[model samples]
Target: MGGEHSPHVPERVPSDDDPADDLPDGLLVADRDGRVVVFNSAARRMTGIAASAALGRDFRDVLPLHDAEGRDWWKCLSPYEGLTIRTRHPERSLFLADGHELLVTAGYRRDAEGRVERFSVCLRDAAHRARQERDRADLVSTVAHELRSPLTSVKGFTATLLAKWTRFNDDQKRVMLETVNADADRVTRLITELLDVSRIEAGRLEMHRQVVDLAGEARKVIAGRVAAGDPEDRFRFEARGELPEMWLDPDKVDQILGNLVENAVRHGAGTVTIVVEPDAHKEGAAVTVRDEGEGIPPEAAQRVFRQFWRGPGGNRRGGTGLGLYIVKGLVEAHGGAITVRRGPEGGAEFRFTVPAGAPDYAS
Candidate 1:
């Protein structure tokens, strides 16, 4: 007789203290009569509706689910009442009364007699996830676009040289070959940055520590840049005091300096200044790289060290946008800290510190 009778619905709606309220995902339940029974905390947060306001109310009256074109979606739920279909619809855009959008996955719960007992909908803020997905896509597109330019140039130049070998004079051939070589170097740099990103993500970026002269390394970076045809007058190096040797990965230091200097040279105007001194407080050495270019905006400064962040105007000067991220990671890896601020010379100043003394070789 018990099995023959229909399932009984509770007289009172489920309270906020219901077991379903503990779920991380937003849970909304409506009984067979379409009255809201379970409006959990997550659901309240997602819809901006208090449990007190939603409980015991008709589901259709309490929740306004609208489509993109502002059409009511209440009719979509009617078919599930008698149907035995239990389904999950992911990323379903549901517009709330206050015009906020929620991405929800909804399901139906049925009784043994093949009747819908209740419906459960899980929800989250769609705008945030949508923005994240868009950013990821933009990063992928930017990297692909950056890589294609150099590859196109290299391929075209090499093909022309190989096909028309004897037709060109020595000087002409040399110029074309040099252009190809430069493009190849560009490709190599991009690939190296990509590899560095992968290594960083996998936590496999191992550092080979040794005693390195801080001031000496900074000089070498400036000299190398100038020797490679960077303007000699554009750079200035100053040692505030006698700098001490640091125990760190020398190559990583070179990379950190090289990236900062290159960013300055590309984005900066006038002269770029590099300063090295002993950090008495941290018992370490401090290095500052400042440029006389248009400094980073106050609002944009915080995002400078994030991966694939290229500021508001985009990468107009052919930057990968990973340099600063890599620099920050390398600084932290060396048990140091780095900061960016507006330089006195009206540009961005990056200062970092590395601990003095040799790293433990035993580890």
Candidate 2:
């Protein structure tokens, strides 16, 4: 008699036709018209609504839902077919009537002819993913924060000593100043390389290129260094024929020359030479810097330009390991290519070619 009077019997306890009936979370199904056609036991439990009461009502009217941005999820979902939705907005936390939180995903279904006929949305809580992101961000922030003060101190002390070099005895001044300067340079290189890598990854690298004299700039870099071990200064210039003027970025050319010369000075104990030749193998201007010191090991020759990479004995001296990377970036940005090889006499050589076309220096 109670059943006859009530008309409130639940759908026959999830027969094979309603596989979603036993799901742990809510399941919903609505027709294209947006009328509630199927509400599982889990959904009833989530929304605290009896199936009989929700059967024919509009899905939105029965249990309202909003997206992450506080927009009406039902309205957005109504027109689209087979789309999933996720929300992470602060104000619109995904909470059920029973005060439980859930991460929701909803998709639609269409008939064989490709007409959207029904849609279903299901949700599972996503408290874990949110926590992981927070932890990762915290770690990067902490590393950056801890590196600040020590780096600043190193740079500051080095500057102070350099500024007051005349006040100290020659022997004491040389030792202190060199050590301080080296450490400061090391720190500066690390910070700069880190920032550049970040910028490159973010696709924000901007190049300021202009017409430049490659031969003159190459000479300047060569003249600045004193030959450490070689009987004569390693810096040499060989013009195969007549050097051609090419349109390129002056700053980038300087950077390229400086990086190559510095690399030669660091690895080669002897002489480093800069040679300019008209491209015989290809059509372009070719510049080569060869060092007479111990050549790069066969295994390491190819990887010389990789980011944060170090060659044999590269560790004895301090470096950010970014010089070659920057060189490569700047060269490529100028529409040129750079290469490394072993010279005939026995040492490492780097050659790069700039194409004949005028580079848009403002990029």
Candidate 3:
């Protein structure tokens, strides 16, 4: 279930640019008399019968949908003999004679006299919905699983401190308080990641753009690590070629840099190096984060960016396994791409490119 699911071919909404034949979802339209009028290519694919074969024929003869109980759907819902007020049959799984399943929804177009004029049915594969449902379930399970530890720590420490405030010495209290603080931060981060995932999945991630200094953001990341007790000598930064000035979300750039650098410092070894340069192959500039440690395997390079992925040594350290995934989403949201490879110094190297020089729509 962790692996990718079957392709989700979304049905196209009928528009001037999107014709019925071009729809990714199956569709069938019939006259009030049940004569097939429109059978799109998707329907052809699902039924393995050409539009020409189905057109002008009775739709019952074409689709011949049956329920799990072997009851004929056409016989069950005689749209022609139904009440004039009948509008639609909501989407549900219905099978063909050969046992191929299709998600089918039927609508009854009504005339001014409240009689059915056209019977329209939208068809889709069930795999897409099944995958979506599984994803939602996974997210819910992950939230519950990930939040319990930190929440318990925060609650336990806070409760113990409140109850035994006078019993613990200053040093002991400080440690407990620090532990609570760290757990609180972890909870906050988990919540933020959940929100980000929600927004990313819903395609509602907002981009507020301004003139950003990409290289400068990298410097800030390095400086932040140094200030947080990391040795300055353990880090290196380089800028190559021309750096372009363009509109971008500076905070998102900072986030991407921070996550990659943090991952390097925590999971990788030796000195971490960051480079910024013009991407000759892409319109945007490029940034690379490399570490002088054992590099990732060739096979895992692609899987590193997916959800719930962790490095070989990941369990020893703590992470939600979402940072790289979020970083990928953020970079792609900026019209950018990210990839990982073996570093020249024998460690993991992550490089990403964002489309530069395009004016943000808000501008």
Candidate 4:
């Protein structure tokens, strides 16, 4: 019987001039009979339904709510006060009559008799939030899949070595031990990337800014890579002109160069080159890392810096694809810009600049 009654059943209701109308959050109040009584300005803007059309309309009929899966969500509402639901459900979505979607949460108010006198629903545009959630889930799933392979290898090798310790020769044991260690290192690198991502997202990436010898730092990175047996002949370091000491974070510089060089050696074909030169336009110096591998396509140059953005051939090289993204962030944090273009050798060349003077890090 209550569902059949018209929305005008409530004789006294709050007018449009009520303070609730000025609230930022959308507020839709329905009477005990489930009729819309307080359709505020914010609610009208959120649902695109005028107060004149919604005020006397049944709440269920006027607010065509739906879940993320497009199932009717109005059924979740209850008329009794004690039976009301109030909480922010991130997975819930509200579908407007015009096909727009909104994220919604609901609450209810009760009279002295303990009966549900009014219901309120708050609404927000869900496009951005929903996209963020979906991206986060994708990242988690990708990272899990990446972690599983090395874990399997580590487990399998260690188990085999333990069981066959007495049966295998010293050389065989050493080879298996090296394989296990490589897998462990792979796992560690993935975990470190994950932590770096977390820090970047939280805006807590620490940068210790001081005058750094750019040429010296680049040489050290190249030396480290060579020492690690990453094709010593494949890497070449060159300085175009006299480079000066710049105010930069040395550790960040190492990370940037290391990621770029490692990426080059892993994906590029013949050679990887690191060049440092004085920036004519700015007082700082510019560094370029080039690889003779398959250069990035024109369309992919911009997207290469995005998190987890791997090209079509990315599968060939086992990488987390977070290197460029971290490099971009660290470079920008030092008040610099980075760009990618076709190298003179017909390969991918990544060029970034470091400011001569330190940026206002306090901000």
Using TM-score, give the best candidate's number: 3
lDDT of 3 by residue, 122-160 (tens): 998777778878977987888788899989998999999
Off by over 4 Å in 1: 1-132, 242-245, 311-316, 361-363
lDDT of each: 0.81, 0.67, 0.85, 0.79
Model 2: per-residue lDDT, tens digit, 133-193?
7756864664465356457767766776778867778787677667766666756666776
Q: Sort the candidates on lDDT, descending order.
A: 3, 1, 4, 2
Instruction: Please provide, for model 1 over 51-141, each residue's C-alpha lDDT reduced to its tens digit, 9 standing for 90 to 100.
Output: 7787766677767788888887666655354357555555678798778988877777677877777777777778778887997798789
TM-score of 1: 0.63
Model 3, runs deviating above 4 Å: 1-16, 19-27, 31-62
Residues 1-363, candidate 4: write the lDDT tens digits. 135656438533558478987787677777778877787787888777887777766788878876666667776544453343442334356787667888787766776656777777777667767788898999989999888998999899889988878999999988988998998998899889889888877888887877788888889988898788876788888988876667787888899988988777776777889999998888889999998878889999989998898844776777888999898888887778999988888788999997787445422
Q: Model 4 scores what on Cα lDDT?
A: 0.79
Worst 10 residues of 4 by lDDT: 81-90
Give me candidate 3's TM-score against the actual structure.
0.84
Clashes of each: 0, 3, 0, 0
